[model samples]
Target chain A: MEKPKHKLLSFAYFLESSKVYNKIKKFVYDLIENDEYKYKRYFDIFMIFVILSSVTLLVMDVKRHIPHWLDDFDLYFVTTIFVVEYLLRMWVYSDIHKIIIDEYEESSYFDKEVSYYSLFTNIAKNKWAYMVSFSAIIDLIAILPSYRGLRVLRVFVLFRAFKMLRYTKSLTGFLYVLKNKKFELMTLLTLSTFFIFIAGIMLYVFEGDNENPNIHNLFDAFYWALITISTVGYGDIAPVTPEGRIVTMLIIFTGIGLISFVTSIIVSSFNERLSVLREDRVVQEVGKKKKLTVVCGYGLLGRLVVKGLQKEGVEFVIIDRSEEMAAVAYNDGYHAICADATKGTIFEKLGIDDRISHVLCLTSDDIQNAFISVNVKSLNSEVYVTARCSDQEIATKMEYAHVDQVIMPEEVAGMMGAVYAGEPVAFEVLLSIIEEKEKTHINEIAIAEGSFLDNKMIGEVDFERLRLILLGVFKRSEESKLGEFIFNPSDEFVLNAGDNLVCIGYSTAVANLKRKM
Target chain B: MQIQKDILLFGYGTFGRQLYKNLRSRGHKVKVVVGLDDYVEVESDSGVDITRINIKRNDDILALNVNAAESIFYCAMNKTANNLFLVLTLKSLYPQANVIANSNSNETTRKLKYAGATSVIDLYEATSRRIVNVLTKPAVSMALDEIVYKQNDLQMLEIELKENTFLEGKYVSEIKFRQMGIILIAIIDKELGYELVFTDHRINHKLDAGDILVIVAKKENISKFQEMLKKG
Candidate 1:
């Protein structure tokens, strides 16, 4: 009785300490860091919106007199939420450190176990680091009391608007672009600075002690130069003499050119960075999917395949050799890689062999198609390969290379033409099947083991009752013969365990049949 | 047979524009169908006034006499569903007209085919094939250069040896390919696969009756080689 009681006590303790600890850790971590978590995303978005609104309100309050009660309510509400967020972030600060340490500890240098005291010390150290971070400082400023008497205290409220940049992906992307183009931007900055300084000095020298009331001192001339060069000419400090006016005109033209140049640079950088971000997003999306098709080539056939896959709501990535084709694919809103598909490293980089279900080598060249087929097969022998061949010779070669399906476009075209000529109605039916014109469509449904329809005679089961038309049955077996398609099978045919029913009907009816089976 | 080849292009995107350019360059009369949202009167680079019809309304589709056009190209934007719907509508209106469509995938190729497209060009496959060919087959590129740029009469021919061919009993080294000014690239044997005969080891081997010699030579020399390989 004492043993059982002790065991129960220990179990309860374990439940209270370890389980609850983990639960709290996960909750806090999700709230603070995990953007992908649904609740966390919503919470973050709500906080961002709140920050934006409060910042806007504060800005307006400074411009004009807002009601006292409204101001107090907004301040208290925003501060309370921010205070709670800050505390939660602080609580999860140790977890973030642990995650970082765990991630890096795989390296030989970091393999030592962090003691409880060291962990506590480390958390404190990280907390200090976090407090000093740009976002953290902004958050603190947003929550801190703004002394009503002090005008400088009101300026801290504007930092809350900068907090929105942390939440918005595009703004972060813009910042990333700025970081990447820092060299060019720095050059532009230094040139503009030099021009402004020279123009200011020239104006100061030309207009000092002049009759013009506005250009009284070097400070005023410097101010005028800035205003004119930025193309924000307020006409406050006009140049009195022709020499001053000509210098001003020259400064204005340089400013216009500089502004345009900077604008163009920023726009181009934004585009480049955005494309990279989009590619990363595509990779992430593909990673989340269980099995995706990797299409090597974004040429005519590859483009068509991507469209078809997209229409069917299938996830796929396109690999193309040409930069132009890859760019086209990317613009078409498909994840694309502009690299040689023949390289085994490309497949490895894409994690194609691990997660890819199918690989379609739709390149027109027979040799390349064969190479891709062989390479993919070597990577993942289980991955289904479908290759397009120009002729029968290439088709034979592809078959010899172990490509599952070798499609000949000319042959298909010829067959399609023959079908069109010989049997128009059949062709129409085929078209209807392919296009899935209406509610009525063809689908392949497998009969699982122990299903009511499994091992039952076709005559015993009434497909008509379910509003399903059985077109054919495919019996898959390991012995004697491989899978055989029994087209328009008689009602007397017995359903096998591994038989697949190829039926035509409304989607609902097919689903109903599947459910019953 | 002399009927005017009036080409109708659906969707004025990249593929459609490319098709229009190719057709216009060949001096074919062509009209483009663009969505009402994107429709704008524009001139081709070659100074051909691009006739763009708005395809937003059913009336717009009806206004364009699709049946009168000799060929219709469905080289629309990347929207396969929209393209499929357009193909279906076009097929329903003019079943006899030769309709060509571009598909992005194999599944869409089937759908386009069944939708009554005379030919469905898989853009990805075609482009990939072209790129691969250009990269791997330098001889093909050279041949293309000769034909397209140089306008030379060079030809690459695959000559199959008959049972009693004049060259059947002789070794590859004794063929006097240098005298013929022809390059024997490889031999495709039925029993054995493609055997590239660059070095003396394979060249010294006796030629078989069923062997196919892949030879690259001038047009005149190809005929001469073919004649020499024929039975007496």
Candidate 2:
């Protein structure tokens, strides 16, 4: 019993080192970001405490009912968590080698590039780590004792918490738009500056140097100009003279123009970013899956392919240069890149060299599709490329390029239109057949030692129990090296430990058999 | 007492350097050409006009402190991103400068506007408009746009060399627009890299494709120039 207990402890340690543990850690990290559980509850409680502490501070300041213990308790609770979080983050950063390899390391290839360097420093320097992280920054600012002794920072902290709203899909979509249209927004800000600058100068000249000593110089004038242009006119600074009033009027007019410009930029940027978010979500389901078909075009025909692929969870990348058409794929969370896929440069830029098992060139242009088919072959001969051709003559060209399939969208549309118009039930039956076929498909299973089918003859294995049919036994002779295998062995052949069995069955049946002895 | 406005030209490109000399000679209010990158940084021996920004990011436009000036002429032919980026950033950061800029295209003009450009002018468009004016009303337009005085009977014409025009082979005076009541002011022929004009030195220069000819003429004789241009 002691030996078994010790073995269990060591086995647990072994499990920790495996990819499964890494995957679990990643999922947990994602969960924390989502803030759906433990962190969200903790945050809500902390927020309540902050609010209560602020109320208490206000009451005490006014010489009202004051509880010293409440103040101490709030301070201690906030400080303790802040310290703990800081320490934990530091510890994690110190053990970063165990969690994630450095980017310079070859093994770090799969890891995402961390966008914020400040976050890394907090993890590196254990002191006040949580206080510096984006959310924590807000918290620290909110609790600072400078004005109202740091309670002023709470408003900022609330704003930071509002950013956490990005975790919600809808809010995240909005934020994504904001980030994507950064340049456009920047442009609007730039344009507004000109008006502000001119207005500032006019105010300074007209208002006089003696009255507003702050506006004696251009920088002061500029500061006033920005505030005035932005319409955030703090009454601390005001123009006194009649000339200053005229300048103020000019500044106000310019402010209107600047506001309109900024609004337009944000609106355009929002739409652009939203479209991109929708595209990315489309292909999120097929991550790391194999034997997926990548269809590059998104047209009336492309929709059919997407519907079929989505039903089967088949991995794919959709390449459509048109932003409007690609918006559909984006909404679905599919891997979509906006570029002229017909260009060879796009392939090089996208790094789509040979990783793809299959390619579907379904662009409307027959010549372009044929060109891409040939290009795909040149890039990777083994990739099973299919193309859509408008003309039947292009079929010969597609064949010359060694395309696995040539689908004519017009022909298919005509057939579908006729069938759907004449017999709705027949169309439904066809759809049902496709759905059934996708749900159950042939997959190869590798034989392992001590497995039930390891030494059994093909006929001896109980296929009836599995609700599966033995498609073929792929066997490699002992004399032949790796990568050399014979397909569809005879029924008399005994299944060896190393042999791969190609079986056709429902997914559930295949999964059960794979798990069973 | 006449108070002089001290103007600073930051870039020393064709427009920057030209505006500097042009404004200076006239004596209205012109100072010096300040060159920071490769060009000389002009500052009075006693006075160094400087403005500081307490921000982490370095902006091109704000650094120039153009808003502090009565007028700033920036014709730095630097990277569009570097130039407009700095300009627009400065406009946002400091909104006190009257910035008159030179842009390359319509797209950039739009960008310049958004970046807080007070006034944006395209070099190509300005040159094109000058050419169109000269060709249409050589006498009146040239005196006003180019020569700036009625006494200096100078006019500018930007002509696109036709595929089979006789003047393609001949030099400026040899092909002679004077025969059509036009005086050639300047020939902007890229074949030679620099714009050749009817100056005292380079009067008999050659013409080529994409050459813009700036001509000068009297107000009454400019109509004859149109007839000559239409004939061949």
Candidate whose lDDT is highest: 1
DockQ of each candidate relative to the true complex: 0.03, 0.00
How many residue pairs of model 2 clash at the backbone?
Answer: 36
lDDT of 1 by residue, A238-291 (tens): 888898899999999999999999999999987776646756666666776777
Give the distance in Å from residue A215's predicted Cα in candidate 1 to where it truly belongs: 3.6
Encode model 2's per-residue lDDT on B160-193: one tens digit a residue: 4544445666775466343454534335566767
True contacts kept of 2: 0.00
TM-score of 2: 0.37
After superposition, which runs of candidate 2 have C-alpha atoms over 4 Å from their true positions? A1-226, A262-293, A299-314, A362-368, A388-392, A405-450, A465-512, B1-232
Report iRMS values in order.
21.2, 38.5
Q: Chain A TM-score of model 1 versus the true structure?
A: 0.68
Chain A TM-score values, per prediction = 0.68, 0.49
Question: lDDT of each prediction vs. the true structure?
Answer: 0.66, 0.53
Complex DockQ, candidate 1: 0.03
lDDT of 1 at A338: 75
| lDDT by residue for model 2 (A250-296), tens | 87788877788777777877665654555444433343344555677
